[model samples]
Target: MSKLRVAVIGCGAISKHRHIPEYAANPHVELVAFCDPVQERAKHYAGQYGAKAYTDYETLLREVKPDAVSVCTPNALHAPVSIAAAKAGAHVLVEKPMAATEEEALAMIEAAKENGVYLMVGHNQRLMPHHMKAKQILNAGALGKVLTFRTSFGHPGPESWSVDGRDSWFFRKDEAIMGAMGDLGVHKSDLIRWLLDDEVADVAGFIGTLDKAGTDVDDNAACVLRMKSGIIGTLVASWTYYQGGDNGTVLWCENGIMKIDTHPDDQIIVELRNGSIERHKVGAIATNEKQTASGVIDAFVESIVTKTPPSISGEEGMRSLKVILAAFESQATGQVVRL
Candidate 1:
């Protein structure tokens, strides 16, 4: 079988940190094209990978004609670029917070369906080992009738992580629909929804400029969610966690609590109701430090070859986006937004 040829769009931190390095390491993949508005960034990646690079996506798409492309661009641009890639006969794997809005997300899905191509969303939290194990235990009734729970995903802000950090496009409302919600919050939202296997029915949230970022978007957000199955919970996401602390997600089920990103060795800690503790020593997928993008990319390739639905599908991406948008709407209206 011919190896899958992949072009990576957006040569920012995400592209460098996860996507580019990942594609380079995948033996079944030939990283042939790199794109960025900045010519130098693209040139750097292309030089490193010995691949072609272009500042224009149209040029990359037309010239490379890759089998797939990873859309690691800004949130607002996700739909248009992904739809274009699909229409050009390439499968697409877009980063999380699939699109800026539910309408755009629906359009992307429609485009993929029309093109007869695979459209997977990059919700890697679902792909993480400990998270998958927790879901398995929850699915097998390890957590009987999950009641209420709460969790968070926060860092110092996008400025620290993105190629530009706070000065990066992520802090711009035009580029990023919501700050922590879209950038980090959506991960936990998707994680919880996937872990519990339920849709968020209603969401009430508060978003504000708790910091001096001076951007129209939020730096911190908190919400209480009601699931379709009546499992209620609270969640918080922030970009001001003091030195990028509190980047963890937790689930409090009826039987016990499962925590992650807290302790190094105790990645998965299961505290049973009967006072018995279960510890699972699971390590994260070996991420190419230069980029954590490969594990998910490899998984996407395997899914395509096997012709199976990904753990995080385009629909799942839409569902997660809905929660965040609903949260934003709830904050604006000062009321619970029903999904």
Candidate 2:
């Protein structure tokens, strides 16, 4: 079988660290092209991979006609790039939050559907081993009825993660739109919804740019969510965790309390009401600084090869983005907003 020709749309930190390397490593993928407004960056990757380089993504799409493309551009460009790739007859794997707004996300979905191409969102948290196991346990009724949950994702900030450091587009309102909420909160929203098999019914929250200086985007966001299953929970995303970072989730259930990534030693811990405890070591979660094979690129390749729907579809990405949008609305109006 011919390997799937893959191209990367951006040469930013995410593209350099995760998407490019993973695609290059995939045995079933042929890294055929690289694109970035910064020609040097794209040329560097293209040269290394022995592929074509272009400053214009449209030109790359037109010339290469890759089987799939990873849209790793800023949040604002996600929709346009993904839509273009889809319309050009290529499957798309767009980064998280999918797009800056719900309308754009929907448009991306529609484009993919119209083009008859797979559109997967890069919500790599779902690909984490610990999260996958948690989903299995919840589905098996091991946790019984999930009563409540709290999930948080925080780090020092995007200053250290982006290619441009503190001056990156992540801090610019026009580019990122929402900060921590869009960047980290959406990941938790998707994970929680996937784990509990429920949708957020309503949301209320506080979002602000409390810590990061000179950035218009919020650095901290704390939200209260009520799931359609009648389960109430708290979701937090912050860029002000000066002490380090905390990316963890805890669920209080009828049978027990389940904790994930809360401890350094154990990746998952479950304490039952009947005096039983379980500890699992499911490997470390991938971080922006520490690059790990997220299984995303491989999964995208397999889905295309087998013509199966991706695990995280475009609709799924839009649903997750809706949670963040509602949280922002709730923050603005000081009232709970329905999904």
Candidate 3:
């Protein structure tokens, strides 16, 4: 089979670390184009992979006509770029938070459906090995029923991870939409929702720029969520974690408690109510410090190749985005916003 020609839009941190490298490593994909407003950034990746570079995504889509496009741009550009690629008959793999608003996300989904192309969101958390195992255990009824949980994602801020450092679009309200909520909260929201196999019915939170001076976007967010199944949980996303990153989730089920990515050696720990403790080292969870193959790129490629819907479809992306949107509404109104 001929390799699927893949183009990556936005050559910054995510593109450099996850999308570009993963596409290059996939045997079924060819790095055919790179697009970024910063010509140098696009050219750097294009040169390395022997692909063409473009400052404008529309031009890249028209010229290369890639089979797949990875939309790694900022939150504000996710909808437009993905829609354009879908209209051009290319499968899309957009970064998390899918879009800045509900309307934008729906439009991207419609465009892909109209063009008969796959629209996958880059929600890598569900694809993690440890997470996959937890899901399996839950499915097997080992945990009985999840009652409540706590999931958090925190780091020293995107300045350390983003290619632009302190001046990165992450801190800007216009570009990033929401800071910690969009960057980190959305990931955990998607993860917890998927883990429990339920949708968020309501949410209440306190979201603000507690630290990180001169930035309009929020740096911290703590929200309370109640799922449709009556499973309650707390989610915390913060960029003010000065010491290190924390990406951990604990599920309190009827039979036992499951802790994930909280221990250094064990990726998963299950403590039963009947005095049983199970420890397993499934795999490493990807973090800013320790980057790993996210499995998103490969999954997107496979969906396109097989002519099937992506695992994290645009609709799935929209549902996850809705949770964050509710959190924002909850913060604004100081009430539990129902989804």
Candidate 4:
């Protein structure tokens, strides 16, 4: 079988660590081109993966004509780049937060639909095994009504991802949009929505810039979401976390409470009303993404060939981005924003 020719734009940490490696790993994908404004970085990708390198994205799109492209650039550039790829007749897999704003996100979605190309967002959380298990339990009524739940995702900032290290666009309002909210927060928003199978209706929130090394955007975000399913919950996303653990989501029902993360043995633990706790050993999702490093390339390639929507579609990405936007607006206005 001829492999899916893929062009990767942005030779950043995500491209280097996940996308490139995963494409290289997948038999269905042939990494044909790479683009980064930095000539050296593009050349480095070419050298490593035997791909054509271009500093110009349009040139890569026009000449190489890849079957798919990964938009691994900054949050703000997501829409423009993905739209360009879709217009160029390539399926697009854009990184999360989709875009910095709802308008931009919708533009990307529209471009993909207009261009008749498959558009998938880089929300890999939907593929996590433990989270899926928890969702199954909730759906099976093991978690009962799911009255109150608290989900969080935090890290010690994104210095590892910045070309300028801790001084990159991630801290800038003009480029990165919102700090932790755009980066870490969107992941949780996507996760909770997928888990509960509902959209967020209103959010009462608080965001602070406390305890971070960089600027303007808040490194910490805390918000309460009112789900359309009548489940009210709190979501916390922060770039101020220290040490190693990225302690995450907890769902509480009348019968029990469930906690999930990448812990060694007790990755997913459930506490029963009778005080008995059950522990499940869960490994991370395997692919090309920011964290979990899950198999996004494989899925994207499969979708392109099969004419199927990916696990995370552009519409799903738009939905998650809206939640983040609503949270930000709520924080700014001191009034809950309707979605």
lDDT leader: 3
The sequence of per-residue lDDT tens digits that candidate 2 reaches over residues 249-308 is: 999999999999999989999999999999999889987767778888889899999999
Task: List where candidate 3 sits over 4 angstroms from the true fold.
Answer: none
Cα deviation at 194, candidate 2, in Å, is 0.4
Task: Give all candidates' CA lDDT scores.
Answer: 0.83, 0.92, 0.93, 0.84
Model 2 residue 197 lDDT score? 88
Two-way TM-score contest, 3 vs 4, winner = 3
Task: Please provide, for model 3 over 34-69, each residue's C-alpha lDDT reduced to its tens digit, 9 standing for 90 to 100.
Answer: 999999999998899899999999999999999999
Query: Model 1 segments beyond 4 Å from truth?
Result: 284-294
Give the clashing pairs for model 3. Answer: none
| lDDT of predicted model 2 | 0.92
lDDT of each residue in 20-71, candidate 1, tens digit only: 7677777788888889888899889889888998988887888888999999
Window of ten residues with lowest summed lDDT in model 3: 282-291
TM-score of each: 0.94, 0.98, 0.99, 0.94
Clashes of 4: 6
- Candidate 4 Cα deviation (angstroms), residue 258: 1.1
Better of 3 and 4 by lDDT: 3
Per-candidate total of colliding backbone pairs = 7, 0, 0, 6
Number of the candidate with higher TM-score, 2 or 3: 3
The list of candidate 4 runs beyond 4 A from truth reads: 284-292
Candidates by lDDT, descending order:
3, 2, 4, 1
